[model samples]
Target chain A: MTDTTQAAPASTRDRLLDTAAELFYRDGIGVGVEVLCRAAGVSKRSMYQLFGSKDEVVAASLERRLPASEAFLLPPADDDRPPRARILHVFERLEVMTAEADFRGCPFVAAAVEVKSPEHPASLVARRAKNALTAFFQGEAERGGARDAALLARQLTVVFDGCGARAVVQAQPLDGLAVVTAAALLDGAGMRS
Target chain B: MTDTTQAAPASTRDRLLDTAAELFYRDGIGVGVEVLCRAAGVSKRSMYQLFGSKDEVVAASLERRLPASEAFLLPPADDDRPPRARILHVFERLEVMTAEADFRGCPFVAAAVEVKSPEHPASLVARRAKNALTAFFQGEAERGGARDAALLARQLTVVFDGCGARAVVQAQPLDGLAVVTAAALLDGAGMRS
Candidate 1:
């Protein structure tokens, strides 16, 4: 095998991306580019040369968070459960997340609140992420046989948003209460027994 | 009555409070004190004399928001209803708030997330505000005749948190959707028909 210890050119990009994600996710994109460059052990010129602008770097950082959110929202394939069960799994994941040390709430929601301009690319991505999750809930509600899937989806989306806020703001794990409550609603809707 | 146009000696204090609230609420507290002083038509020395530091000014500005929140959370005496109805009324008020032209997400939540330190007095106030809300839901759930009142209260709290985030982040109005959804949950818990 080649000596992997040598500094790699691509490693710089990775370092920059990782540092940007942490700072943006923790503080917000309003943090200056110079701070990010220093934290990443790169010069401003090199950072600009690689990422073009601060916005692009923030976009890249936000893109890193999507996969984790996707995993949180989706159910495990081996579970083999009804749509309601699958939907509830998302909350279970969130509960676990809230229990993690240094949990500061949903990064996407936090970022969405901080990024002022709706037209900003980072804001657009955050919005799309929320929309995608809402759409997924809508699909799940429909499959679960709600009379008004759209309404149910919207409601579930509200619960999801509330759970994240409670988890962070209250500094308490949401305790899977949102899922249990949502499941009860679905069952009452005649979607489940 | 005294001349209405005659400004009181303490009017400067009120002006600083008003300007800080407007700026801090519209933009985050990061906006410089000079800007706030200019907007309020007060001198920097006067601002310093009135509020010693920026943090003190920010705390005072946030304190001003508390009354509005209290009004929203606790409505007029003639508005008396059952616990479930009262809970729904809170969301109804929030719907109006979300539709306002300058609506932002919860100032407390925004401030809490930015401050990072849980020990900060402002952060403590933010936490207390959230806890107060949760306690309100719990009290309502218990009064509504739910067997598992605490569980139901926590669930409803999540719904409130979610609605607030969605209103600001997704630009969605918290209307009949949250009300209907939450009412359905309370109904399922046998709190309502």
Candidate 2:
């Protein structure tokens, strides 16, 4: 057995962001800054030195989440599925996420709801996440030859957002209800059911 | 004359709940009890005397919302309208709520997301709100003669929940996106298009 196989622990700043992500997403931003610092095993001075303010930390936590979220909506690189089929696949991914023990609905939505200012840095990030998803839907709808790309995009976005909301509010795990609804909506749009 | 004609002020307990409902819905439940008491103009001791705890205040706040929320989903008591049109009318009610200057997303959904515990009194209210909506959908689906009323209830719930989430998160006032989707879904289920 190797005696010195361990890698270095996460850096102080990384540790703080990781902890902040979990706390803010799990418990909302009402958690006091002091409580967060202590939970992260970080000194207040170090946290300030690294992130400037608690609001910035909230923004940074969501920023760190961007990559995984983008991946969730992005169709697989290797699959050659039709655009509409690929779009519907996002729900399957949502089901897997909802089934996780840590499923807390959409962090961006939670962040936006907790903040008062639309101008808040975190609110901007949250808004951007949703807007980007609508763009994804529009692009997919266009690829699928929809009669009205914008309409399809908004409908898809509503259903996707609804699934997250219903999942968390009802405190039920994912159930593919949104997927079924989306398929029916697509059929009515003249796409193959 | 004005002084003598003035009605008695609201009870301190009612004041506290009124304030709590406004604050908890406008902001998340992350608002401190001190802030709530200040806004309510009730001393902390008096607030505790009435509601016993902040969590109970939150629970009571959602409970206060029940009648209004139910009215939004309920069909007209004496009207003989078709089931699907009646169901889609809920979105029209939602649009009115969304247009209110003080409108936030569903209060129960907001409450559920902020608190960590599913067992939290507020979370129970949220789950109950969602369950009640699902039942409304199932009843409507059955009346509409859908082959699978339960499935329609769940799918409709998903779309309805999505609309609220999308509204608050995107900071857009409610539009008819959910209604249009619901109409198409109903048509697919054998309701007239």
lDDT of each: 0.76, 0.79
Model 2, A1-193: lDDT tens digits are: 2434332233777788889999988878877789998999998998888777889999998988888888976687786888778888877777777777777888888787777556778888988888888898788788888878788888887877778877777667767776777787777777662
| DockQ of candidate model 1 | 0.56
Q: Each model's TM-score? A: 0.87, 0.89
Candidate 1 residues A1-193, lDDT tens each? 2545445656888899889989876666668888998999988988888776788888778877798779766786576787888778787787788787777777777776666545567777777888888888788788888888888777777787778777777777766676787787787677772
Candidate with best lDDT = 2
Give the per-residue lDDT digits (tens) of candidate 1, residues B75-128.
566867878788888777777777777776777777666554456566677777
- Please provide, for model 2 over B1-193, each residue's C-alpha lDDT reduced to its tens digit, 9 standing for 90 to 100: 6654543233676788888988888777878899999998989997777676899999998888888788776677885787787788777777777666666677787788777667899889888988888898788889889878888777777777777777777677767787877777787787661
| C-alpha DockQ of every model | 0.56, 0.60
